[model samples]
Target chain A: MKTYKCYCIDLDGTVYRGKEPINETVQFVHHLQQQGKEPFFVTNNASQTPDQVLSKLSGFGIEAKRSHIMTSAMAAAKYIAYHYPGKDVSMIGERGLHDALLENGVNIVSSSKEVFVMGIDREITYEKLAQACLDIRQGATFISTNSDRAFPNERGLMPGNGAFTALIQNSTGIEPIFIGKPQGHMLEMIRLEHQYEKEDMVMIGDNYDTDIMAGINFGIDTIHVNTGVTSTEEALLKSVRPTGTFETLVECI
Target chain B: MKTYKCYCIDLDGTVYRGKEPINETVQFVHHLQQQGKEPFFVTNNASQTPDQVLSKLSGFGIEAKRSHIMTSAMAAAKYIAYHYPGKDVSMIGERGLHDALLENGVNIVSSSKEVFVMGIDREITYEKLAQACLDIRQGATFISTNSDRAFPNERGLMPGNGAFTALIQNSTGIEPIFIGKPQGHMLEMIRLEHQYEKEDMVMIGDNYDTDIMAGINFGIDTIHVNTGVTSTEEALLKSVRPTGTFETLVECI
Candidate 1:
């Protein structure tokens, strides 16, 4: 376990099913901690807050701190704060984004007749959309929390932040500054969190399009989990496949 | 206008900006009406029902009958019905999908875990996701409304049905039968709707990934509008460029 300085695990399939964590996950995580290896819980699901995720993991007895987790939503908010701070933002987002911005002390307004911060808001409205258009036409900057359009749920799939991003972009004729997964910022943030540079990092996740692709795009090592849509065969067949494949952490560990 | 038999106009930049219709869009639509050309409003936006779309369009004084409008949401439900008829479904969608499936006379249940049709639901919940996963594990067939991931909107961009499609795909290791733009079905539907064969019809819209590519994929002439994010320059530089490019409909007309 010491051989791996940093181990990142995906939710949904790799870690647990719903509220129930994987059988081997707890033992493996305990082993890693005892071996002094740092573990990171990372996901492309931008809908949930880190606290929410941490709480979910806590249900499985894996005590994770907010600092121990990195989400696309958080990463996106960090990107915006770094590049365009102190701007009046018109937000279409969930608690994750609203909390992130408030943490950074960014000003948010209801109207996009100002700059718009795009986030995953499950309760989207047409009036909000109208305000976003108004902002874009009024020459507001467009910022996206992340570019991931969808997230897998037990019900099938749900529209992630990118869905709202796409709609506003089409109507307003403005492109957004994407800040999350499948982008470079999250990689940097993860690297900083794990105290590993790009070369030493390995991204473990279930989705190929987000996790593996993020590693590939950022020139980092990737490990794909078969627990998601990507089978062992599918991972091997990718144009830019991951460096390793695992059915679950039980096999990899 | 009589030189063309069908008038396929894109929603965002081609028709209106936000709720306000674009200049000359009203006249061109009226022009088509007067010239006795059949008008079809094609949108890759799978969020709203066709009637909702019509209602929105009507807000700006553009009269659109629900029958004259086509969306990916409609295409997705119909495609699923064709393959998995009379099966209980878990729907991850908004009113658009609900209306479409209802219109198609497909039976839907709340706890359907066998066959599912996923679309963009702004108010998506974990229960819906869990049900989808449970059904898939139980050998359920998954169908997506579209694969666009995101669509252009006045709110800067929003999660389109494609985003919803991706979630289920990521979880179940299943690929959806996409029904919207850029996919083959919508164009086939367009041909059928306009009573025009592939050779005689032309697809005009703003999106390159959807409208232009769908047209090209189906062997029809394409007219690309820079209504959405794609500028006229970007639209032409595409590997699969459109047959013609216009900044706006008025320019082409």
Candidate 2:
């Protein structure tokens, strides 16, 4: 098997499922760290800050570097900063997205018709949604973090950011630019920051749609593990197959 | 012009546009009432009660009978009462829907796996939406009051009940049964309640998609007025034309 310089791994369903970590993936990460290689943790969860994510990973017995964390919120903020700098942005999101925008030096306004970004707002309201529609109607550049329709919770699968995005899109007849997996924005951010060639980096994840597709879209090798959304058999059935598919990351070791 | 026994008039675009009443439409209603025909006011607005709609009409100097008002909320409540009797309904909506459900003797529960109904909720919260998704995922029959993507307010067009319905539908992958204009539920309820023949009824409105489509779907006569969403030229271009296309209700009067 070919060794990659940069291993971009997914968090949920790859490293850990809810609070429980996949032991094989954790062992695989440990092995990579022992070899002096720091793998990047890529996630579509834009609700939690890098520190929160690091803490969650620590609880799973996997010590992940803070700088190596690449959340969709961080990517969305960086994307706005690089693309539409100095523009006041109206947003409907939580702390992670707010902190990321501030960290990226993006101006956060109460309401803006210039640029609008959305993340998973657990504290969402109709007024916020109405304001978003008004802004979009006034020709705001609509942007969303990810497009996961339903995310699993303690109770069951709950509505995700994509569902809210769909609402806005349906109302305004305007599509938004999603800066998450399967779009290559996050991967591109990691590549641009670390100056790693596409060939030298590989995406390892359990989901075929977001994780593997993100790698494929970014022109990198993708390894699919059957610990999450998509099974190895399902991954193999896709027309554009991942570089490798395994029962678990244990096979990779 | 062939006179209809039952003239089902739309509210927002036909009778009035926002707070201002269309003088011609108001005069047309007077003409109908003078001829001893009590025209029914059909509205897809699920937020306002019948009394509120009546008060609005009364303010415009059009003496509307309380019994002659048919709202989407009332129709939804009636539909639930008739079809899913004794089943608990989980809902995400406002006071109008709440009152209607109670009036129709339909039990509204906080959480239900049997049925779920949604309307335009201005006080929308993420938990409400999340709960709706969970209920739907748990095999609840999803229902919505209307399918208006956006509605005009002081601040341009705001997201409507349809937009919220789209969110839940996207999240749970369950299509909701929309009981509003363009669906014929309101028209059907009027027919059932008044015992009016389809030929004796005429749906008059400015919108071709909702009002005219509802009439056509219900197998009744429809009049297209060039006063709202659909223009006379646009209405003429549709494959299925209305029974009567006029500049305004004054033409029929």
Candidate 3:
């Protein structure tokens, strides 16, 4: 059992996509655990809840504890509460945004009242757009859960909250205060969660722009997997090349 | 009937979405033709062909001659052919990129043999990514339709090719030779299409980051539509404001 201080991994395109999980990935996680290593799954996709992700993973025979998962939405929630006076107004999104708002004790609103925080909302209408427009017109501050527009899935890329934010912005002159990765808060969340010094950590993922670059931006080591959008050869040739590169996390060990 | 030498219009939020159309938008075109303006439907979405867009618009009850459509994809393809030579490449997009490549007379390949082009493919995959990486490593060049991460829509923002491009770039260190708006070819397309001796021909669209700014970059007049991404008030408030700002094209008339 090789004991490592911390282990962070991306969810989609790495561990699983939709209802399916890479069984080899599950065994690798078990292998990591058996080796006395702690594993945590981090995801940029803001649509699903940690419970949902965990359940999906469990279906693939990988048991992910509630604490074993961290999401951009939850990190965003904590960031909002820490920065704002009390989350006076939030335009809001799906369960992730709601969960964050409630956890941070921030208030979510519909009309032109308080702060208008926007995120991924599967349920949307012109009614919500009208309300958000009114809120922005009235000078309520604007915020967004993340700037990711389309999230990748088995079916392909689907619209995320960045599109909704664009919708509200199109109706109002406001741009959101973004606190997701690349702009930095998720890294801080990772730090706060594990108390691991930045020197002790290495960010690993498939996407270079979001995952590897995000780690590099935060001054952390990155290991890019040629597993997602980029091919193995391309993954090997980044401007800010990863400290380690592999076809999969399984290969990293 | 009012007569004009040239006619140019907007796309995406302006016309068909999925399989639906906004009310009265198509009717406006009929009125435009009644006025005897040479019709040209200009678009920022570089995904579809003229026939495809025309067909989509026709399904939505707005039929246009294929020649009446001006797509950024076509513009990009022409730009590439005219500028760079002897580089036949592999592309991973819909009919739009395919048509663009063929029209430009560039030899298109989907395999590793002398592959020189990689166009935007929203319907991306690991196999495509691998092929692109292989060709790239073998010195194949890259081109993209557009860099937009997502298209703002009635439903929400759908992931555009830029997200896919980033995936490629992350993997390959090969930033594309971009040919869409606000970068290389769109301005040329605008100038060539409008044929206005007066540069005062205004480019109107809902996307501020691309459309308005691209017009500005091209030294053309632009009208910011609040229906897209940048609101009217915000568009006006910017230090570099649009020539005109409207809630919708209906208001401009």
Candidate 4:
């Protein structure tokens, strides 16, 4: 197996299944750390801040630096700061998105915005969604963190930010700029920030559509594990197959 | 101009614009009443009950019988009762929907639903939406009141039931059975209840997509007035033109 300088790993399904940690993936991360390599925790989860991700990683017995975490919220903030600089942003998200936007020096506004950013907000309201539609209809640049339709929690699969974005898009007839996995913006951010070549970076995850597609879209190698949303059989059926497939990260290591 | 026994009039833009009444439409209704004809008020609005609609009409000096009001909520409840008899229904809507469901003798359940009905809910929550998605995924028949994406209000165009329905549909990949305008369910219900023939009924409204289309779909004559969302010019451009076009309902009278 070939080794890479930067291993961009997905969180929810790859590292852990909700609250339960994947021991094989944990040990793999430990092996990488022992070799003096820090893997980037790339997640389309824009609901949590880097510190929050760090805390979760620490709970799983893997010590990860806050900078090693690249959430879609962070990528969205950076994307806005880089592309729509000096533009006032109206956002519909939680603390993670807010914190990232502020940290990236993106000006946030309540209304009269030139740019609109959306993320997974558990406390989403009709008023907020309505405002986003109004802004987009009024010609604001729309951007969303991810296009995940649903995500699993204790209750089951719930509506993700993508569904909300779809609602706004359907209402306003505007397609948003998605800055999460499957689009490669998050991976691009990691590559640009760390100054790594495409060949030096690899994406590892348990999902094919988001994680593996992100790597492929970024023109890098991808390893798909069978512990998440997509089964190995389904992944193999895709025309654009992953660079490699494994039962678990233990097999990769 | 040909007169009909049933005048299926649209609300909002046809009868009143938000809290303010359209004077020409108000006088037109009075003319119909003077001729001993009580027009049926048909609206895609599932938020208000028939009594609430009656109050609004009375406020405009038009005393309307409660039976003469047919909201999308009423049609949705009736449709559910007729099609899925004895099925336990779960719904996400306002007081109007709740009232109509109970009035129609449809069994309403909090969970373990056989059918799920969606309406425009101002106090929408993630949990409610999540449950709706889960129910649909669990094989519950999904039904929505209307497909009006946005409606004009005091604040501006607010997200309608269609937008919320689109969110759930996107999350679940299940298209809902819409019981509102352009489907003709509401008009069909009015016809069935009043036993009026198709030629004896006419849909009168200002919107081309909802009012005129509903009449066209129900195989009845339609009068498009230049008072609301779609102007007469826009309505004329449609291949399926209304039976008659008027500057106001006064012209029809």
- TM-score of each candidate? 0.57, 0.99, 0.52, 0.97
Model 4 CAPRI quality: medium
lDDT of 3 by residue, A83-178 (tens): 776646646577876876687787665554667767666565435655566666677777776666556554345555565565455445466776
Q: Which stretches of candidate 1 lie over 4 Å from their true place?
A: A112-114, A193-195, B1-253
After superposing candidate 3, which stretches have Cα over 4 Å from the reference?
A: A1-4, A170-173, B1-253
If candidate 2 were superposed on the true structure by all CA atoms, what would the RMSD be? 0.9
Provide DockQ values for all models, in the order shown.
0.09, 0.91, 0.04, 0.73
Docking class of 2: high
lDDT of 1: 0.71
Writing each residue's lDDT as its tens digit, candidate 1 over A40-72 gives 887766668888998888888888767878776
Lowest summed lDDT window (length 10), candidate 1 chain A: A149-158
- Residue range A1-253, candidate 4, lDDT tens digits: 8999999999988999999999999999999999999999999999999999999999999999888899999999999999989999999999999999999999999875599999999898888888888888888899999999999988778999999998888777789999999989998998899999999999998889899999999899999999989999999999999999999999877
Q: Per-residue lDDT of B1-253 in model 1, one digit per residue for the tens?
A: 2246766677876787776777667766777777776578887676788878988887877786677788877887777677777877777788888888888878888766567777777676645655675666567777776676444454445545564455455545566666777776876776775578676677887778877887888887888766665788988787877888877666655
Against the unseen true structure, what C-alpha lDDT does each candidate score? Answer: 0.71, 0.94, 0.66, 0.92
| Reference-based lDDT, residue B239, model 2 | 97
Shift of residue B40 alpha carbon in model 1, Å: 14
Model 2 spans with C-alpha error above 4 angstroms: none
The candidate with the higher TM-score, 2 or 4, is: 2
Sorted into a CAPRI-style docking class, model 1 comes out as: incorrect
User: Every model's Cα RMSD, please?
Assistant: 7.8, 0.9, 10.6, 1.4
